[model samples]
Target: MKPSIVLVGRPNVGKSTLFNRLTRTRDALVADIPGLTRDRHYGHGRLGSKPYLVIDTGGFEPLAKDGIMYQMARQAQQAIDEADVVILVVDGRSGVSALDKEIANRLRHANRPVLVAVNKSEGMQHGLVVADFHELGLGEPVAISAAHGEGVRVLIELALEGYPEPGDGEPAEGDSIRVAIVGRPNVGKSTMINALLGEDRVIAFDQPGTTRDAIDVDFERAGRKYTLVDTAGLRRRGKVFETIEKFSVIKTLQAIEEAQVVILVLDARQEIGDQDAHIAAFIRESGRALVVAVNKWDGLDSYVREQIKGALDNQLTFIDFARFHYVSALQGQGLEPLFHSVDAAYKAATINLSTPQLTRTLIDAVARQAPPRNGLFRPKLRYAHQGGRNPPLIVIHGNALDKIPESYRRYLEHLFREVFKLQGTPLRIQFNVSSNPFADKQAPREKRRERKTTDKAKPASGSPARPRSAGKVAAAVKTKRPSGGR
Candidate 1:
């Protein structure tokens, strides 16, 4: 397991900025406002080859009793308890405050290794900035500018100093298909995950935002391994008031990017909204293999089910490639068939495409219906080969391919999907327009040959003989004069 480094401090101390620097990703939202980060945002980072996990928590207001501040404090305290090392980020420009002292006092009892980071120490004297933080009773303070990326490497190095280098125990490539479950708030994502595992692996509460961090659970079904990533529910940005919810959306998006497949859970009792369509569009754009799960489907009447199906068709017509299942997560009604679709989707996403086969398919499709001509340019698709997998990419070599319209592209996509039996994964086509050999100028060898031919055809300015005849005559004259001297 990777070591966890938790960042704790008062608001606007640049913890989120430092989290971004450490993870080499802008997953954390940063602003000058206080208490912007409420929940624990987890990210992976490495120092050289040593991998570790970093957690960013909201501002620690230990004194607050009941409001959002108290909730943030609880989240931060949980992170501190789980941390292998805790870095208390402080504003170096403002000097130590009462809140910083309170946070320091709270961390002193955390029983974990604590390091004080004096942020925004770019132009100031490092020694002076760090001198004020040593009063917090934590060892030496490390001055770092998270925004400017100064001394961050040193801070992480110090934080990870004692941990041994990670071994090669990580799972091999293709060992398991990673699947992320994502959708709007309280969509029964966690409940479905628990039902799939046949155990309570995660907290499946009835309220929204119960699962803040994207939790990964490994399991096997029918001897096939899978890592199911249960991600936070994404709410609309306008309605997202808590700063933590904002970062939850980021974590969910990151989870989608890291997964090979996605299970978008929807509520059958509710009408499909713009947020649902937006999520579906994002999944399609991500190009991940998808399986839609309409949860709470056990009690809905036939009319309601039909209405829901119609809504899905009308709103999410773009994701026709994915398979949809009406599942009752509580009862586990339709999960078995859902898993079958999952395996099929994964196979389709990773299926190999040979050049000869792809080319043949392209040729057949073109014979059936040639691409429409754009003015004088007629697109001629020559051959195609597999460019990538897990959202298979087909790279086609052709002429005038840049002139191919969107409708023609869709036609090819549909043809390829049908031909290859790509049911659940989105297929992508990329055109490599073969440049004309003589469009701008002749080849280098052809240019050299043309120059030689021209030289042979055109005579010298003062003589009609070949260009080499003068040199041969000079050589003969020199030879005759040398013989007379001998």
Candidate 2:
């Protein structure tokens, strides 16, 4: 759902390396060797004031399909097709090659939004050499050295512009993605947002409750708009209803209400508490897409880190579907991936899948892996219907419905992930089972028992029941005898 940003170009263009850099974590395998990345490895990533999904694909090559690299190329092309925005990363030192032109031609046909990134543009000596790559006809290439972290920001801004404006009438249509930065007091919520925004749009101080009102600032990166709303820090429950805090509470709720999404920041230095969970619950109750960002992640040690992460996620169990990221707001680490996840989750929540496409994909998924078999009587999974959205739910109807195993359910999920590409979106499935299609009713046992019951009620002993004529004679005799006796 997040606008997909895929890096494509010839091999060894530092795409995987950039992916590692942007996401602020080593999600993709990086090496000096060309074509180290074959499969498409993806991670949540962000740029100034914007979040998106970054897909690091295998390098592109032309005139060669001889071996593993060819397969890698195939995968890269697939990523290009799936992406909302494509970055053609050309190596500045090597200059452009015939392969780059081939890739450009393929990308031109893709018709998805694209940007040309010229990497390794360090020092003036390399500038003239990189200038010749403009001949690719994709547009002006953003020249920078990704290893040294130059020009990546500029290119990111360019890439962020590809995000389409929210559907027609949504407020902030021409403006930025309106984000409400919120959390308990002194959790460094405002500081985190400010760090990501990279400007003092909101005041930052060591004071726990310094920010007691909602403030909105128009933030932009690479021409894309983002509205960052910094609000009053939340307080503990027992002291919550103080007379002075009335306006603050109202303003905080209003800010959350107005936000398209809420970034709930937590202090990683301290253990996650009831207050953090309470804020997350508030966001969910308000029907806002919530992203749990653990600020000050740099201090986490190797030990107990997973235990703490597990603790934070335990609160989100019921909502198997919220996004969480560990970030160091002060150092500005781990933000790209966090924001990327935020963007993806938001986009996924709003997207509507076409019925025909969904139907086809469902069928394909069923073909790949059959539905669960309770026993000999497999739940004859008939057809699936898109029951709802806003967290898309699909209902599958079949027989013996209860026996379907979670294992098979996960398989269906994987298939759905592949076919429809519902990344970062929570999927709900309802299984329905009905009577056998070929039979008038269930198996013959019930009908046979009914016939047997009727026969048993008619006969008293070993003899058969009386005929219709016999029943009439008996009724006439009984009427005459009863009248005489009366």
**lDDT of candidates 1 onward, in order:** 0.88, 0.72
Tens digit of lDDT per residue, candidate 2, span 400-460? 7678888888777667656765554556677877766768665587889999999878867
In the range 1-486, model 1's lDDT, one tens digit per residue, is: 457789999999999999999999999999889988887787778899787778899999899999999888877887787688999999999999999999999988879999999999999989988998889999999999999999999999999987887433223565887899999989899999999999999999988888888999999999889999999998775676665655466567767866778999999988899999988887887678999999999987899989999999999989999999999999989999999999899889888889999999999999999998889778899999998887899999989898898999999999999998999999999999998877656677688999999888886676676456888989988777544454
- In order, what is each prediction's RMSD in angstroms? 11.4, 24.3
Q: Check candidate 1 and list the clashing pairs.
A: none
Q: Count the backbone clashes (under 3 Å) in each candidate.
A: 0, 9
- Give the TM-score of each candidate: 0.60, 0.47
Tell me the spans in candidate 2 whose CA falls farther than 4 Å from its real position.
1-175, 239-241, 246-258, 281-287, 299-301, 304-307, 313-323, 360-378, 385-389, 395-423, 430-486
